[model samples]
Target chain A: MQLAVLILEDERPVREALARDLGHFGGHVRIEVAEDVPDAWAVIDELDRDGDRLALVLADHRLPGTSGVDFLVLLLDDPRTVHTRKVLVTGQADQQDTIRAVNDAGLDRYIPKPWNPDELRSVVRDQLTDHVIEHRLDPLPHLQALDAARVMPLLRTRGDR
Target chain B: MPTDVHHPRSTLPRPTHLQLAGLVVGLIAFLVPLLVDIPGLEPAGQRMLAIFLLAIVLWVTEAVPLVATAMLVILLEVLMISDQALVALPEDVLAASDYFAALADPVIVLFLGGFLIADGAAKFDLDRNLAAVMLRPFAGNARRSVLGLMLITAMLSMFVSNTATTATMFAVVIPILAVLPAGPARTGLALAIPVAANVGGIGTPVGSPPNAIALGALEARGEGVSFLGWMLLAVPLMVVVLLFAWWLLTRRYIAPDTPMALDLSSSFDRSPAAIVFYVVAGATVLLWLTEPLHGISSSTVGFVPVVALLATQVMGGDDIKALQWPVLWLVAGGIALGAGIGATGLDTWLLGLVAWEALPLTLLVLLLVAVGLGLSTVISNSATANLLVPLSLSLATGLPIDATAIGVIVALACALAMALPISTPPNAVAYATGEVDTRAMATNGLLVGGFGAVLLATVLPRVWDRLGLL
Candidate 1:
């Protein structure tokens, strides 16, 4: 089973760009892209069917009908996505929406509209690392995508068995 | 806190072909001895042979978890051959509690202390800080830094589990790897930690499970090695093998002019609890080393810290709960297996199959080491010891050799089998870093393990005799 990252954005170009930026983690992690909330849910369904974990969701705050904040809050109620780390990657989120993302959705990180590729990758890495550690996942299979130093303590608990 | 309303319960694992084969073969192996009458063996011996055969197959194929197989051995011993056996044995039978006692065997208690202290060391960040401080003197040159890293790793591995030591050292080395030009130097640095950790595991009884298994088996036979006594027997081989590995890895991969320097900053924990832990940990080590002076058995010395740490509230119930019980239980299973084999006359029956005396003693020793090293190269080291230690101790009975030497050699040989990624957990950790590939690991592992094996087989036995350590 693989840890998967889902990119949910309304714009095709934005979805492509996010997928491209995360291309390095493609083989190590399953990267799925969806144009909107419906597509995102479809991707989650497929992931669950394939025995993949929805480890993180990178979503744009602006969507067509249901806002990203709404989806994030919805995720809190969905058992499958409750533990998934949530990130909002848009400059358009108002203070109220951002606050809900934090208070209700448990947003892990916010990537401003104009974000550095390096910082974006680092945020994703940090969030993924947190998800793995908090859930006590075996870090070896996903070591390349993780902050290697941060996961050493988890490895220590395995002992020599 | 969102309760995992839909927490994905894992799907039942599909058994592999090997596991299926193991189940079928194990049943056959277990039954053959019980059903077919042998001329010389007793009923209890036949029953034990069945359990032993089943254990060998299960451990090899890992049809079940290693610890599960271990627990199975204990249960089978109790039900099939103990005084509480379903079918009564006319021969003398040990009580079922005797089999259960393997779980709390003194050596297991000794490991309980070692693991707690090791966990405590990591809990307080003492291991990483100590690495930083101890690494200061060997900071600049590439080779010197590797040497320092290996020595410190081995020293830590002497107390900590080899896997944990490799992980801790890699945490320290990963940053340095990013700075250094990625090449043989990166490979060399990655390779160093595991080699040191595996070799270093032989340094003490509590260093690894195989040592505890060996010590436990030997103790059961009325031959116990003290904590210091084990060091005297194994440390010299450990130091020699580690130095040889350092030289091999450095010459093969690291250039002397390589720009490698270690960060040497350490802020040690100085809280009241930390201070109390420091003294308690210190006193425990002092007591362990000075076992000759204090005359306390290592297991009792081992347990003092367990009581002291809890009493002072430096460590608590949670810490006890988190201790590596699976490892402790696996060791218990091996002890039970050993006890059952020795008690039921299974060892004698099995040993009689070979004319072992016809083979020269040195050749016999070399063969034992080779089998232990080879078997553990692909299986769990503790499991290898669990099966081999009992048989070898029994083998030593008919021969004119120190039984302690045979048991210790087999245990050390198992530790020396680090030739593949699957060889040991430490090797697996190093392999996960992506710096050391299979080719690099196998070449380096073979060279170091081969060298260690040769010394262990040929030289170490004579050295032990000369030192009067046997």
Candidate 2:
């Protein structure tokens, strides 16, 4: 099954930049962009219908009506996306909101604005590696997008079996 | 796997408290008319009252998307007032299609035109250039610098959303603020932009949503204020309030007398498309102002910029798509509510319950203005105006005062409410900068807002008579 990475950012420029920065993984992973929470859910619905696993979500904290933290909390309740890795990419999340994201949403990482592209890609790679290992998915098929060293032991074990 | 992925119930997010509140309010509103009996109230009026109540609650709580709430208002009105329903009064009372007609209201179109103009200006950097040019004169002096920034912000807000105006002007003032020492002076500079944007939004019909709502309410009553007439009253009032706000800010955050030079040169585009936009914008404003001479309503004039901008390619499909359609929907909903109020005889019935005729005109105006100011300080200015303007109009009917005057005063009062971040978008934008704290904002906002209320109550009555409106 294909793995999906969702980018939820309201600003068009930021959303496009994030999508472009992660374009190298587009061949193996579904890279999608949503401008708000509702659009993000629509993306999830489409990916689910296509039998794709939603592995990661990079969401902005501020949105039109519902906030990104609020969306992340909702994801925890959905059985299908309970294990999805959640990251908040925001410039303006307040202390209270960031704390809520960390405590309630199990946010895996926080990437502040003006982020280095290399660091962003590395975070995405690391998060995907964790998802692959934790879910016990076949690492060989998505090895290029995952950290090779971390998943090599799993690949070897599967090979021996 | 398909069943797991397609669990419709789990796929949808759970209802929020806001949503639950909206549902409860809607249920209560719908059931009230059926259960409660009021003397001299017709069944249709009762139903309209229910719809109005539901719309107001949804708007205030923001339980649903504002546009969806607007659509609900139309839907409920149509369904509840159906000819086959028990409360049906007459076939001509409200045609099913008239609800849709509210979407095409001239005032809505007027705001559409205003949005297009703002979009076109931003597309070509026209607003920035104009701001720079306007700020050139007061660049060197510290106190005048505050005035200049406030003046420019307020002027821009008259044509665009106050939030957009504040955001844009905030960028311009950031460098200036950074150069200053970290103190009240910097804080004052930050606060002035939003304060000006809030106050300046009262200057024109297109200045703010409340003004547009006021105009829509007036137009519904067959009494309208021309674009120039609004400017004639509101511009002067804004200037007075702006001066008061500037004084309050400067006194608290007293800046040094150092003359700071600023580069006012603009990189404004001189392309053919931009030139076309300028010409179209000028002509549109002219037509709006000289509407009496041209015999074309401002709403009709609104079509010019919309067509010209599209034809000139000044604003593209993406920009059009990004326009604040929700605000338009909100305005339309308010207008629809007003129409519903008028049709159901709710306006007349509610007015009858109040002995407005017995009260002195001045006392009545002050009471209305005071109520508007109080509510707006707590709720959104647009929602406040939406609730108050129509009621003010209905109350003023058959009184010695002109409904337009009261409507205009209420609109201004709504604009004047800036004591809290929740009161207006501009104030919220200023508060977000991390430079101005809530206490500072509330203290200064209350001072300015209180002074403004008194000034408006005193000034509007005298001026309305001189302007032949009263």
lDDT string for model 2 (B171-240, tens) is: 5776676577777887788789878988988999998888888899898888988898888878888998
* Candidate 2 ranges beyond 4 A from true positions: A1-161, B1-19, B82-87, B90-92, B258-263, B467-470
Clashing residue pairs in candidate 1 (N, C-alpha, C atoms within 3 angstroms): none
Candidate 1 off by > 4 Å:
B1-10
- Tens-digit lDDT string for candidate 1 (B99-140): 999999999999999999999998899999999999999988
For residue B436, model 2's alpha carbon misses the true position, in angstroms, by 1.1
Best by lDDT: 1
Whole-model lDDT per candidate: 0.93, 0.81
Superposed by TM-score, candidate 1 places the C-alpha of residue A131 at a distance from the truth, in angstroms, of 0.6
Q: Report the C-alpha displacement of residue B225, candidate 2, in angstroms.
A: 1.2
